[model samples]
Target: MTECDINNQTISRPGNSWLAAAVWNNSYTYKVSAHCPLHYCLPYSTHLNFSIPNSQCQFKRAGILCGHCQQGLSTIFGSSNCQKCLNIYLFLIVPIAISGIILVLLLFILNLTVTDGTINAFILYVNIISINTPVFFPQLGKFTPAYTFISLVNLDLCIQTCVYNRDDYAKMWLQLAFPFNLIFIATSLIITSRYSTTIQRLTARRALPVLATLFLLSYTKILLIVSSVLFFYSKIFHLPGDHTELVWSVDANVPLFGVKFITLLIACFIIFLILVPFNIILLFTRWLSRFTLINKFKPLIDAYQGPYKDKMYYWVGLQLVLRVVLFAVSSLDRNNNVIIGIVLFILVIGLHGTTLRPFKNEIKNYQEKIFIMNILILFALALYNHGTTNMTAVNVMIGLAMGHFILIVIYHIFTYALSGVTRNKLQLHINTLVGWIIRLLNKNPVHQSRLDSHVMNKIPTAVNYHEYREPLVVQD
Candidate 1:
């Protein structure tokens, strides 16, 4: 896989960075081009300026430029402005996630365990020289000297083991990890496709940042996955010694133990690298007021949170969460794993399409009914799961669709009716319940109008004696 020479290279965008485009050898499993020219992109610049890049968007930091001659910006997955990207992420993720789990579920159903696991290892950095090793010296000849031992190693040569009655989870997940990475690769490619090609401008640079960002995002999941498999391997196959029991098999014939050791070491380093910043952010958020957390996550739910964008974003997130729960349950050694997995699979599929239902039929009343149904669905799931009542999967699916519908509709009610400041406080405080009851029992809030009272009028005249004046005898 060599990069094409300058002679083989052609201009991509009219005025964009040339480095954005790169051609790999035929051996590469996947490829992605860029599509530029989206209006109002969150470029790594002040006010979408193309010259200077900022650290705000992860894509721009990775050198993914605009498809158009324009460059220096990227809309990230969780960015409030990039809800579409989030939707795409979830859309791709749903199936990919389900695929691996489905394979595991199948294995469970068949009661089969196939053996598969990673080579487990750790580094033993002997700061001091090793004991009893011969060291060559001019003056001190043929002396046993302590020397540091730093070596990459292969602990074992055999690769067999995906089969296990109880260990299938680890085995199946291990098998799927690398292949599952292809899903991430595909996701990155889709994001690349978002950078549409223009007649004059090249957008290939956008792929750089998109790929980088995705790789980082995928890191934690991958690390955890690989580490889990490695740990599983160590437990299953290892040198039966007190000190080296957790490491790969120490047999001399086992090939490339060094490579495996370094690989594991690098993996551990990657995990460490990934966790540092996240922990920083977590600590910072904790240090900040409670409102910071809300303000932070507000963007992902921003546009669709209103009546504006597609409700599918919210639905996708919720559906993914539910799918996770279902998978968790399915992983348990229970007969109901099949039934629950199937039911949740249907829900995951159904909820996605549920948003496509005619909006006209989803009037306010219908929406309210959806909210009520969501409340019912919760109870129904609990009851059905516990065997309190017998309900078919279809019935559960219908209930899920209705409940899913409620996600979009309930937000409107929450924002409008319940969110803002309200005058729920009493203007007039009543001391006792009896007083309020007696007060309400009266026909009128007040017994009578204050204006109905009798009234008297008087006029005063001023004179010398008492500031009163006398009238003349004009009538006589």
Candidate 2:
């Protein structure tokens, strides 16, 4: 053991593994030790000399040990192997850590419809719309396939930029996310198909449950669309890397059979596979209507008639096409071109929605129009701020977009709150309050007396009652 003395306090170095200090304050002494083992490093080093031992290390109280402390410990122990072992451990650990997180999230999303059947259609639609928005705006020049994948979870895996390469990490995430999203999409489709009859029955009995299931199915479909689009985009616009080595690239065709192949498959699946049941029902009902044997089941066929009649599958397919177009335009790597493409797409969809009104609910049709208008204005601002160097204008546009998003969210929430009995009751209360106020205001003594006098002045004094009475008696 070695001893050092400072401020009448004794500091002791016990063995090669630990440094201990006795601190004196208010006639009390407390011992604090830095257990700097040869294999493990403590972030903070204890100053052995001071009465109150101060920490001399720069690292904050984050869980991981700092490099300086590790190097210091390794130097004191005369061993260079500690850093190598730590690096190997971290190399093995990071992927496992991120994979665990992804698995948890995947499980949660997969179970969302099953565990919670009360999800609101309006809120679900708003979420789908918001999340499906381009994570990287081309005008901002931050467009990267890595960013698109990272934005899915919105997690900051690396706090320090130098710790890990972001592009590589994004590639890892893409590999993990692709498979998980595929599983989610497949499971969701199967579950929805299995419950199709149940949903139809629920439709005739309880509307809310049916709407929730339908919205959930739509959400899964949208998720599939988003995943497929990103996968396709990544294949088309590759980063400066060996494409043959990357798992998500078209050249690295292994599990996906190729990114382009999978994308085409998904597109066809979205356009046709999901519509198979509806087509079957339509064809079956048409064939049955010809034979009088199934005339009694006409009512049953009518229950599933709305979607086919509205040609809503075509509308959905159009949506997927438009999304693909938007992403393709964004890949052109030109800000103004992207903005113009967005504007044109919005115009086309706005026109289509306005004229066709795919939704059965009139409110939803109007809501879609309002949402399109807001998005159009936001993109217009982006276009105006395209070539400008003014930070203020850019910030203002971003703020305006955020404000519009908030307003749309609030509108959806307000609409959801004012539905069914709630809206009716609120209306009744408002009408009652207004009627009460009017009656109270009309109860003014001066006004009432004035009205009575005005009526008195307009009345005849006498004589007319006799002629009126005679006519009434002779009418028989």
Candidate 3:
């Protein structure tokens, strides 16, 4: 709870996990770089200089950061006046958790059911160019390929025609993969860095959900990598079964099995490369924080602290090392998939970002960022499929997904830009604007006046009035 002066003088506090940020002036405004809990420990190389919190309640109020509060508040009010805190979990987090589970399940089910030719085509979805002709694609007439889809009313699955069954559409998806993955990776790295910073500042009580989300993402990616490797590596097994027409099975003994294997290995490697160095730096920083005082490193650390060049070198170098390691390890996949497993672990680590935060801010954690990213990425994929194919089902999905994507993107981007001095004002404004959308989706829209009146009643006179706005709180 101690605040530093504007003079930049060192004011060290002992055994204080509560105050990680250095404040200038009495207002508790924080230095962005000094916001991580381990500000006293090691320097953060991957943290983003996004808007920092400016109030005491930010650090004190239920341990939620300004950003996450906005989201939770949306959920709270998304129902009716957000009558209880549980609504926050129900309205916001549950849907995302469910989506992630469904996504993982879909990946596995699709992998298991798709024909070997289809699996080969799926792997080729990232290839720069297509080699397969229409004949290679397993389709009935032209665009529609066959799959078993459940009929909602009958609760029965019947073989139906879908664009995903088309080999050409799969190839088209790969054409878009470069930009899609590029955007996804870039955005994911940024969010992961943000999550790292948030986790550091979070109290044990506040961090439970964030930690769980991180673990979930990690587990999901592990499953994805394992499933990916299994599907691709199966070419080597040459298992006797009903299916033996896989052209991918041609290279069973090669180091990575085939081009697709190399491609996936490289993809996983790239993610691991991003994760390793950042986490290493975090470990080093934490270890150093406990031993070194400001006075000891001030003179030396100050030299690199002002300019961004050397730091950039460290940052950029670490990123390049990811690429280097990926290619390096891909050359030697020895020891019974151990290397693959190790890389898979690294990919999961890399996909998740750095761990450090000054004010246990839930503003944007791994889950929110990853959830948004996946949705957007899916939009890009769905859009591509819709455009390339003539199937009615693909077009219908695209129609729905694109519309949802556009609405969510617009609503989120617009409201996220709105910040207020008081959590009440911020949440109220945010909840009022975004809450309706949430309700609409949940199919339980309350009258606007009712919600406003309810929210007004919940906020005491001292807390709600704009004239007596709450000061922003940033915790460490």
Clashes of each: 37, 0, 18
lDDT of 3 by residue, 358-412 (tens): 1122332332333323323333433445323334643344344344434544543
Model 3, total clashes = 18
Residue 211 in model 1: lDDT: 30
Give the CA lDDT, 0 to 100, for residue 279 in model 1: 35
lDDT scores in order: 0.31, 0.40, 0.31
RMSD of each: 28.8, 19.3, 33.3
Off by over 4 Å in 3: 1-219, 230-261, 278-285, 288-476
Instruction: Give the alpha carbon lDDT tens digit for every residue of 1-476 in model 1.
Output: 12333553322222111122222454322211122112222322212212232221222332332211123222231111211122233254455466544533332222121110000000000100010011111111112111111100111101221222212222224333544454455444445556644511232223333332223223334433444334322212111223222322211112225774456446656655644443344234323325765466443223112221243223323322443354344323234544554465455335524654312233532443343344235334543555322334423443454344345335434433442232232323334666887666554634433222322223343357543546555566
Q: Rank order by TM-score, top first?
A: 2, 1, 3
TM-scores, each model vs. reference: 0.23, 0.35, 0.21
TM-score of predicted structure 2: 0.35
